[model samples]
Target: MIDAILPPAVVAAESFDDPPAELFPEEEAAISRAVDKRRKEFATARLCARRAMAALGVPAAPVLPGPRGAPQWPAGVVGSMTHCDGYRAAVLGRAEHVTSVGIDAEPDGPLPPGVLGEIALPEEQEHLRALAASRPGVHWDRMLFSAKESVYKTWFPLTGRWLGFEEAVVALDPAAGSFEARLLVPGPVVDGTKVTGFAGRWLAERGLVVTAIVLPSAGP
Candidate 1:
């Protein structure tokens, strides 16, 4: 059985242990296998997604794979899922009533080298560099990485295309524990062209960094 932790709607977190069976057990086992660690990570993510849907009063539907290796949620609901080392989290909301939501969690650690150059937009890279220089020991790099992943999850479902790190600019307000992301060059994946804003927050705790993002709802 999976364990779930839920908070109120403003922000929430959920986690669960990996299940023994792969989410889809009926399919023929492929000759090549994912590393043990990745399989565990996938199980944890699926487990959290189920619990999160239940917490949000959405259907706890079975995990189903969709194009580009993303999970497919039941109709009328929007959500995001993520997992790292030992924890997973999912955030879901009624897209008709609430805007798009994205959630991500990762084990806290030193930032991977060159990560900033890859993910931060030009202005954002300069801003974060200055901030890091000003406060030498801060974990701004990790926070920024978490923010980027959250932004992608928030944007991908609505746009249906992969977004590059340079295309999205992130601005963080440390005092408020919040951040905002803007899509600079709408990529080939997005259509209809109305999504213009992204914003979110990051919380660091117990060796983990968690962030969430909100995008406007696609209306009827």
Candidate 2:
């Protein structure tokens, strides 16, 4: 599922079932005080990450969390991790080939009541409503939340700033299995000119929704 959106330069690992891998000591130390579920998810996500590193030909090392809880990748590497029930994935690329990457997975279900109102702008909600009207089976609201999350994950490393939900408008094209997030702020400077938003791809299957974005062409 994750491979469809990634380029050949990117190495990715994915698991539909938990693999028998333990957390490295440093990773364990960071999550030691957390609940068991959190620990399990962290360990599993790292397992996928390790496979990605190996595929990228990087020696194994501690993939620990940084100040803001984002994974600290090896020097000259950029990557992202994502996990949800029945799915976990990691993508890695050389820093020269990609500026940043973001991936997320979620259960294919509707957001809890009123969540759409919180995370979407008036125009965004209207768009979602139209999408829902056309495709009644999909939970477009939840997809927007997931897309916003992917947007932030992709945005932060590039600009080192916070991106509010209302600050970006998401438009999803179910037919194409893609989405675009238009920034409401000054937006990040990609290449030379300031760009409005990030482009991403999505997949909804087997009761899961997965999204990914990579900044390869938009150099660092």
Candidate 3:
């Protein structure tokens, strides 16, 4: 399902059930004190990540969290991972072909009361309201939140900076199953260029809402 949204250069792996709790020594150290549920999720997400790595012909390595809880990928690789109830996914691409990748998955449900207002700007809220009225089947609020997550995930690796929920103004296209985020603050510089915004794709299906943003490499 994730592969459908990503480009051909990216390799994606997903699983619906938790695999056996297994982790490298370094990975185990990262969550040594966590509860069983947290351990399981961490282990399974790494499992999916390694699967993507193998597809990219890279050796399996521990995907430890770097600053701000972002996965630390191997040199020459860019990737992201996300997990939710009954779903875990990882997507990876070589740095030569893809500059960066970000992915997130969430339960296809409404955000808890009062949470939407906090994450969404006024204009985004107005747009979501219009979407809900016209097409009430999908949870536009959650989709918007997921899109922002993808935007942040894509931004951090490039800038090593924090992106608040209100920092990026997102617009979702229901018909295209795509979204674009316009940055409020200064954007990241990539390949001698400043990135002002990011465009990504979203999917709402099989009880999950998934979003992804992939920035292609600028050739030398």
Name the top lDDT candidate: 3
Q: Please give the lDDT score at residue 44 for candidate 1.
A: 67
Query: For model 2, what is the C-alpha lDDT against the true structure?
Result: 0.85
Q: Which prediction has the highest TM-score against the true structure?
A: 3
**Per-residue lDDT tens digits of candidate 2, residues 1-220?**
8898676878999998876787778887888899877777788889988899999889877898874667899998899998888888999998888888988889999989988889999998998899999988778888888888889888887777787998988899989989998988997777786878889888777798888888785444
For each of the candidates, give the backbone clash count: 0, 0, 0
lDDT of 1 by residue, 1-220 (tens): 1112222342344554666534545221421277878766766676666666776677657665566666677786777777877677666667664556677777667678877677776788788888678755447777788888888877777767887777788887776778888778754332355666677877767677777775544455
Candidate 2 wrong stretches, greater than 4 Å: 217-220
Q: What TM-score fits each model?
A: 0.80, 0.94, 0.98
TM-score (C-alpha) between model 2 and the true structure: 0.94
Candidate 3, 1-220: lDDT as tens digits: 9998999989999999997856899999999999988888889999999999999999999999999999999999999999899999999999999998989999999999999989999999999999999989899999999999999999999989999999999999999999999999999789999999999999999999999999999975
Q: List the residue pairs that clash in candidate 2.
A: none
lDDT of each: 0.67, 0.85, 0.94
Pick the winner on lDDT between candidates 1 and 2. Answer: 2
Please give the range of 10 consecutive residues that has the lowest summed lDDT in model 1: 1-10
Distance from true location, Cα of 113 in model 2, Å: 0.7
Once superposed on the true structure, which residue ranges of model 1 sit more than 4 Å away at CA?
Answer: 1-13, 16-32, 133-137, 187-193, 216-220
